[model samples]
Target: MVVERDELLDESCRGAAPLPQEADRVRLDLPRRDDLPDIMYLANNHRIAANLATMPHPFSLEDAKALVQKAEAAHGNSAFFAIRLRTTGRFIGVARYANVEEGMPVHVGYWLGEPFWGQGFATEAVHALVDHAFTHGTMDELTAACRVTNPASRRVLVKSGFQYRDQSMIRSLGAGGSVPIERYNLERAIWKSLRTWGRVAS
Candidate 1:
């Protein structure tokens, strides 16, 4: 079922008061008007643009605005968050869960600005989002995909507990070329087991 914004907010806020403290690492709050410029700059960088499917080669303010609007319009079945450093409040990247098909699985994707690529922030942010999805939503599994050549992204997904599934050739919507992509997934049961294993190991 498609989740509406009001419903998501209501559900997200239920039983828990909104925290007043600044987010020490990552926050999933709604994107704001001021974030457009930075979002475009980071998203359009050559390295990041090459990794993503839909990011334009030269991302413009218009592209950022359009993305923000689409993100806002999308409710139940998908949600997007602007990744920012808590202290600086600068846009580092974007992460999202979408294509939540019933009886199937929900998919997630994300990118980090080149400057933030090696910081482990992507893994942390994705882990939090995965926790939120499994705890708050009904999906039984989560999946993600990345360009086959991008080992950095693959490492992040592995650190977040996703297992490599298989590879497929898909048309790149951004680069306008057919590219091979590797898929990965983690079922809720497996995720739970892995967490337990980690606790025991520690």
Candidate 2:
């Protein structure tokens, strides 16, 4: 779904209002200092820490603060947000788009809390994030990467309309090692086509 830039920004500012309340889901408005504690807890877990490129294995509150600070300083080229459930109003994870090379492509990344896995929250939030990126950011193609071993994450990306493109041996900047990763990409035309089909079916 292609949300207008103005409407998407307004909804983002309003915490994604009008969204379903079943899980209290909403995208992050602006990262706050209070969000650090929960972010630290969820991100440091073994499962999450393993898949991401930037999350530390022994993540600390200090680390979380530094990350928030860095994100705060970053503008147009990158953006980050805390994902939360609107109903319970609990922060569940983090999502962002960064590493944007003008006239090339934009990279999308996200990680959810362990407890929130197996639910459709990640997919829903990713869909929203993808829409936000395409509508608001300067990019025609969106790309993401997942460790070859992470089937669950691959599923999430596929459901979000990202098609697997290739595999490469990448140095793990987060895990402090080398690992193989599967890259995925989605172009604007492809995204529009998929959405059109969905609307036709519904």
Candidate 3:
């Protein structure tokens, strides 16, 4: 089914680009210093860290600060948001659209605090970001990957409509080495179709 339309949709910019889209329960926005405590606490879990690349084990306050700083420092064609609940204003996770270097497809990535797992928050937040990337941003396609073992992350991607492409080895910084991964992609055309169908179905 099409995801429910958010009240934030009416508040969206009519211009070429819009962001910080919201749903009934959560909204996506850039990481902030005030989010440091929440980011540190929720992100310090072994399960969360184990599934992510570059998430420091025993994730520290400094690490949280650096992430916020980095998000603040990033200029254009890149975004990182701290996902928070509207009801409680609780910081629960992060979502990003970035190209770590030139000449790379803007891949999507995200992680949520364990408590928020199985609640559809990751998929909702990701749908917002994906819509922004395809509708507002100028890119042909977006790419994503999940460790072969991470069925959960893979499900998030599939739920967001990504198509599986291939398998390869990638570094899992938290795991401290290379591991198998399943690559996925969603092109502009595919996203357009889904969006159109969503409007029609709704």
lDDT of 1 by residue, 1-202 (tens): 0011111222222212122112338765455679998888777776676666666778888878866655554344456677778877777877667653445567887777787877778876777666666665667888888888888888778877888899987555454687788888988887788677761121
Question: Candidate 1: where is the Cα deviation over 4 Å?
Answer: 1-24, 100-103, 198-202
Clashes of each: 2, 4, 0
Best by TM-score: 3
Q: Model 2: per-residue lDDT, tens digit, 1-202?
A: 1100111111122222222223225655445688888888887786676676656678888877865664454444355666778766678876666653446566777888888888878877777777766666666788888888888788778888998889976555455787788888988887788777761121
Superposition TM-score, candidate 1 onto the true structure: 0.81
Q: Which runs of model 3 end up more than 4 angstroms from their true locations?
A: 1-19, 199-202
Who wins the lDDT comparison? 3
Flag the better candidate by TM-score, 2 or 3.
3
Span of ten consecutive residues with least summed lDDT in model 3 = 1-10
lDDT of each model, Cα atoms only?
Answer: 0.65, 0.65, 0.71
TM-score of each: 0.81, 0.80, 0.86
Q: Write the per-residue lDDT of candidate 3 for residues 1-202, one digit (tens) a residue.
A: 1111111111112212345678668888767888888999998887776666677789999888877765554434556667888787788987777654568777777888988998888878888888877765778888887788888778778878788999987666666777788888888888888877772221
C-alpha root-mean-square deviation, candidate 1: 6.0
